[model samples]
Target: MDDRKKNKEAEKVTITPSDESTSEKGHLFGLDETIESIKDAISDFESGKILNIAIIAPSYAGKSVLVDEIVNIYSHEVTKVSFSSIITDKEEIPLSEDQSKIMIFDNCHYLYMRKIGGFEVLHAFLNMVLEQDARLCISTWNIHSWNYLGRVLDIRKYFPVQIKIPPLNSSQMKEFLLSEYEDGEILFVNDVEAEDKQIFHVVKKPLAEKATHGRIKLYTLKVNYVALRSLLMNKGTPDETAESIIIKEITRISRGNPGVAKKLWKKWLEYPIIKTSNIDKFSPSINIDVDSRFILYLILSMGYIKKCELNNIMNWKCSVDDIRINMILFELLNQELIQINDEYYSIRADKLHLVTKYLEDCRLVW
Candidate 1:
């Protein structure tokens, strides 16, 4: 590893045991409709309708939370199986002979890979789901993988009841983020500089050559305003409190993703206070070749993957060797587009939106 990699490794944040506990108890901010839909599906199943459900959402958008909620509701009848990594063998899937009437599979995306002959495990799993008539099966999938498989194998037909998780709005985000804290416990500090807080700034500009001389150019002060979209959004909201402003900014930046919002909240929080100035607005520029783009898509689709897994996927899919794979991952790491935690590489929480946008633009992700 180079110095930059060493420095990045050194700067990585270590999550405490308490943080892990809090994360495991994830909040269900915008999943009421989803839960209702699941209830209706369960009711249908109870009425002799063998309708299997597929819950689809992007990574870190609370798919697991939704699964946990389902298990909680049907605690006496649901058997939950969660896959933490890619499942290459059907034997890896659990076969429960318990009395539970409903089977819930979390992270079903792991059942298949994007490479050729990768659908064997998934095909077997689907057959098992189809052949079983005694239990109602509910599975969760990454939205991108779901789309791809739906197009390729018509996978949607297998699951009649498909529920897509919705994003939380600004108000909902505020409520969810502050749920664990006392009212007014965390101070929202507005520490933006006067110039940055204003819609316009006066900048000095040099005149054209016709009005300029060597080292003596005519200078003029020009009034320049911020982006039009930003101005319009904040036009009639001058009376907004610091807390409201911070929440709105977080909602917009996170694109209403609860997982992302929580990560941002932790990043901005300084014990009992958060400052507007602490919000990160810097977007990393991504410019990589086609090979690197595909690798990035894999990382995004998997949420987090080990380097060895990346090598295996690349070698199977495109016959790319380990050395080239390492180079591409290094480039991505050097740009700070992705990060490594506990030997798993994943898109940085703060750069999730930027990375997703880039992949969407390149048609690497749906």
Candidate 2:
């Protein structure tokens, strides 16, 4: 076997779709409203309303799962196809003949480009949708791709029914994450876990400060990140349960992303007995240059990427020089924003929030 294949496989996570939350089926715990909205939209489609739905969300926000659910619901009518990367042509996409039918294209971002003028397939698909009859098409897109396309092609105008998946609220996030566990089955350790507990009150420099702190007003109750986490956790409250508090903090940090929240919870639960105090303390902010951020985005979009494929991804994006990209990757490794085992690279489960937030602010992620 090749040395690359001989190396270990990347870590994996397993989720039970059937063990979904109370609100919605599957892992989409807090998306009852969205599901309802989608059903209503589909009903309109059935009525020949011809509503084209664009489900805009970030990676691992259950975009595929949501579409899959809708497909299962309308299996007799909807035809679904999934894409992973750039698609130059629409030859492979099957068009529906029935005017009242539904067509679903997941990862529809594959049709557009970030730079400019490279989306012939997207244009063709839009043309097909517009020129055709009363049939409805439902497509999913990365928030970043959708934003870029909005500016480039005004794509939102076409998707009259845009279902932007909002982050799950505290209650919804709690139910979603805890759905897998039986009542009080998981015992949590009631203490904050940190490498060093010493405090730092100094004003951070632009390098570190810019990434973590957005606004600053002197003596305006500037709170340290760790301290703020401590404050929001509702610690020592007789009424609040540790599990609820932990889920609240996780939802806050994860911004209601089910995948990120689940991964964070798994990482925190290093042992069978959950024993982590301040969940926020686990979130670490790391600074990165432009090249590094680009690399991080690629890995995140794909969720987990092969270590050997780093150069391929960088080149695909036409990123920095190979040597420089290697240097940035090494720096990322040093920062522990990502983990490498065998021949795969992945974002550290705890750092999902930090990474997602950074990309979101840049308007790069969904």
Candidate 3:
């Protein structure tokens, strides 16, 4: 393999659940209440009441990490089966004749597709869950897919206990990111000057109507509303440290999603030190046709998918061939909206929210 392909493989290995131990996976930063709820549901299941759980969260928001933590808690009894691609048939599911009473299915959103006749496998799986009175099923789903399925199939009824992962606050984010490091091991540098860090800036834009044949420039003052709000909220706190500021900015940019925050942390960190100016502030604007939008939605829904899997989904849903799918993937990769690692494509971590918002605006995703 080429160097780029090797790097992609390495990244895939790093993020793979099997490659990391329970402690190395992720800290349950803001999920204490969620964990407690799942534990209660498990207890009820053990007591003859099969209270199945559906853990819902957006992609890269630590759905798998949460599932891993749950499995660790019930290591002796829980059996976890994580899906990395769509399951076109019910038989593809790995629910074996195991003695374990608790079954954890991660990425349960893969059970169905958005196309016609797509719910057959999911219906079958649900039926199986209903028939298996002795087994308790705990499934996880992409929030968008769960919403769509809820509207269409009323899937929420199948899972009695629904747990939505909550976003972490600034302090929680700091603790989660710093959990892997020793105290004072990592440095937070505020390299930008105070004046440079102002919440408002002047920008030049092209005039809507030019006075002459030549182009005209218009100067306007633009305010960073998010930064302004942060400043206003922290106005009374003058003793805040650079670490606090960096974590706050990270929490703001990542929208408190732990996976995104972790990726941002990796991007900004330069060994033991990270600077405020290194934080990513650039947002990619997505403007694509309906077909591309649907493809993007598929990637977001599945989390990580191979090109062949995309081809299969497109063939079933839209009758689009591999070449056209490749073109669309190329366009998305060029736009930095999606990335490929070891032939598996997923929404770029930094662009996850941006792509989801765009899809929502287009009504492609709920």
Candidate 4:
């Protein structure tokens, strides 16, 4: 056999689908409210009022789509400039524009770092926009990063009209599923179990007896890219690969952050498949070497069964090591995906709901 085929066969992993229906894009039922909000922002700016608006929230909070919708719908007047994973060169920012122009810069956080050496140029660009009565929309993961932009770019004068895009609620999730996945599956109304402590549900829904810090986390952009790419890679033909199914399922586990979802999906894809039912089966067990993106996912699953501690999980059939646990937990805590309480940590309730139905669709959880 060819080495490549041997390698793939050696790494063969098993995944379960929640259901036949899940979406792979758009505003399922309608993001009219969100779309209108963007249009309103544009209207306010086009009326000779120079505006600096900041779209802030956890990752997967739909900041890019919100602005993208505006740009897509009003392409004549809106100019889209993306700054993701690229060095920000201030000179490259479009500065010469009339009042009718609406400039959208996605991922502004990468630009304000002192290391980039482009903050001053960005400041100059913003100034030019204000002077020309043009509107500028900046997208970022959170408002905290804006402090860097403020310090370097002198945006305090603008104070940036902040618009918070909250994660999708249950109704919105249904719309998302309809738009992204196929139709005919039900959205989650309650959490369900797969087996033992392997809980499955949407990322934004409440799990059975889950502790809450009253918050939700979206995946980081890097994590999202990883997950989406992994899904595409595994499925091979874009046919009925488990990647899309994993996407919906992990969405319940990872919420909407493409990064976290990607990691978990990859891990799930990489998990060892020990035959259980002759039809090919593998029981979900904690294992080391899971990508850091699934830290919150493991933490969230703890609630499905009591007495499953962090240390014990490392020893499960999944073969998770202590070092991996420390690393994953540390990353989750740093990202605010999971908050530490007095002794235990819990997944953000909002995120749990987001991917709940996805899990159900994959049949990963009950």
lDDT of the candidates, in the order given? 0.78, 0.66, 0.79, 0.44
| Candidate 3 collision pairs | none
- Highest lDDT scorer: 3
Per-prediction RMSD in angstroms? 7.4, 8.2, 4.9, 18.5
Instruction: Write candidate 2's Cα lDDT for 219-299 as tens digits.
Output: 322335654555555456545555666777788778788877888788777554665453545455667877788788766
Model 2 steric clash pairs = 191-277, 192-277, 192-278
Expressed as tens digits, the lDDT of each residue in 1-366 for candidate 4 is 111122222321111232321222344223466556666766776676545666664443445556555555665665555543223356655455433355666555444433334356556655664665435554443343454345555565653566666544434443454443344332222111113122222344333334554454443322233335435554565333232343345554545544344344334332322111111122233232344433444444332111235444334335456555666777655654555544456554434443334333443323
Error of 3 at 196 (Å): 3.3
Q: Of the pair 1 and 3, which is ahead by TM-score?
A: 3
Which run of 10 residues does model 1 get worst, by summed lDDT? Answer: 11-20
- Predicted candidate 1 versus true structure: per-residue lDDT over 1-366, tens digit per residue: 121233233321122223232223347787888899999999998999989999998866888777766776676677767666677878877765545688888778878888877899899989988987889999888888898899889999899999999989999999999999999899998877454555444555555645574445555544323234456777886666779878988898888888888889999999799997887766657899999999999988887677877776766345457668888989999988899876778888778889999999999887
* Residue 316 lDDT (model 2): 41
Of the candidates shown, which would achieve the greatest TM-score relative to the real structure? 3
Instruction: Identify the superior model by TM-score, candidate 3 or candidate 4.
Output: 3
- What lDDT does candidate 2 reach at residue 353? 64
TM-score of each: 0.83, 0.72, 0.86, 0.44
- Candidate 2 stretches greater than 4 Å from native: 1-26, 96-100, 192-239, 278-285, 297-349, 359-366
lDDT (10s digit) by residue, model 3, range 87-159: 8878777655666778887777778877777888899888877877888898888898898899988988899
For candidate 4, the 10 contiguous residues with the lowest summed lDDT are 274-283
